[model samples]
Target: MDCPAGVVTDNYDIVEDDELWARIGIDWSERSERSERSGDGLDNELWARIGIDWSERSERSERSERSGDGLDKVDKLDKLDSETVASPTQRSTSLPPELLRATPLYEALSGWCRHWQGSDSEVELFHFSRPVNSIDVFLNLGVFGVMWKAQWKAYEGQCGSHDWQTSRWMKLVTLFVVFNSQAAALTSLLLSAALGFAEVYVGAHVLPLNLWVFCGYMVFLVQLCFWQRIRSCFVAPWMVFLDKMCIHQTNMPLKQQGIDGLGTFVKHSEKLLVLWSRRYFTRLSLGGTASLVYSVKLL
Candidate 1:
């Protein structure tokens, strides 16, 4: 007020004003005009040219913040959608279904539902109830020497192994009974079916027919017929990886997994019962002994 102000000082005051001041000039009259225009919520010619207006700072900032937040949320949603659209299997299996619905997996499932609804056993909806223990309270084991059959009785369940999370200290049995021919596997299968049916319907006395059961029509009861050893371990629901029933023959992926996991199976077993005979080793170098070779290598 005491001294005449310079052009820089005049411009600085206008720039720092709480309201938008009109006309960026050093003239006092123009500065007074800017003050008159302050409270109107709009600005001068320069601001108008750019389509900007003097909206309240707080309100404008609030709107900008909301827009930023919305954009961030949109980006996350888009990423989730791309993942599901690309491949549904890539979705994390760990997330609970409630949370999964907003994700792209929900979209993928919706798209999939329109085409074909698989069996209830195979697919599930929002109310995804996990499998009720398919393994019975008691194990109905059918131990066939055949490639894909079993004759199981209702043995006890593994008391502590509810989630298949057994202690490493607990070693189980893996019956390595890979014969050189399919006939051997067939005989073992027949024996399993016969013994299972008999024990349930006829009596335990008829179970002895298994001893005469030859794999490949040979005189070999190679379904690990050492009942005394096996029977001793039956007090607990012993995890017996029986030869025929252990594989998922119809499922190629499962079959390959079983084949690949043989080494691990042998390593963990407390008892690796190899149902070996002269024939197993006699044709050890031959064609059909691939199973025998894998078993031998694993051992």
Candidate 2:
């Protein structure tokens, strides 16, 4: 058989063109046997059996051939191909310790809350503990800062009622950036104020009734100011209601019942706050929760 043009062969040293295999010669008589043996593609297993390491060969090529990106591209392709073949099987084998622990709990909680419903009269019949101060949710995410800044801006004529009410710029891009920026600035201000309040609240043995009332009033006022406006709806700090903390995690009966009540808690609530992440949507339960909340909102 004739050698193809531009084809570099690994056995070229053993079969020369001009001398025609002088030092190391190939017997044409056994060509049929050799052809049959060489039928397989040059995969990693073939390279291993022949005592050749593709990884080392690729590394050497990368270091020596810097003039063109050909070798680099080939190396990257090989790496990606190998990873694609091996990745899926190994993906779940190396989960973080925290993730491994939390995944089960997340799944269980989500399953329990999947079919929860809320009726108009269902007021906290489920054993859901309301925080001592309902205003804690507002104070938690620096929402007060957001409110204060907006009010101050309104006073200073920075953001007027016209700007808030007008639908002049109905463009999505305009709303996402300009409106979001304004909302973010207000939120930052509210957060700073909330942090100050939190620090004071922590150190003081007894918080005065006036301070509590002031905080609550600020929260309520801010809620009204931004009600219909978009502030990345999930702006509030998540109210952590863990099974271990709030429900009996080890007790299956109690755990299931408490988790089921979570849907009702979300149902009656005026706002939905989701703590988001890349892994959040992957879990069946979390996706279900989001869907449930969204369906409720749609209704």
- The candidate scoring highest on TM-score is 2
How many residue pairs clash per model?
A: 15, 6
Name the best candidate (by lDDT): 2
Q: Residues 152-230, candidate 1: write the lDDT tens digits.
A: 2111111111111222111112122222124345556776677678768986676565664443244224333332233
The sequence of per-residue lDDT tens digits that candidate 2 reaches over residues 1-299 is 55333223342222223233221244443333343455422344434644548786566445535634433454477889997783422321222222111112122123222312221222322233333211111111101111111110000111001111112222222323322345455665676577568668775446454455456446544543343233325464334233233433455665454444444333223333233334445555555544443444233
State residue 140's C-alpha deviation in candidate 2, in Å: 14
Score every model by TM-score.
0.21, 0.23
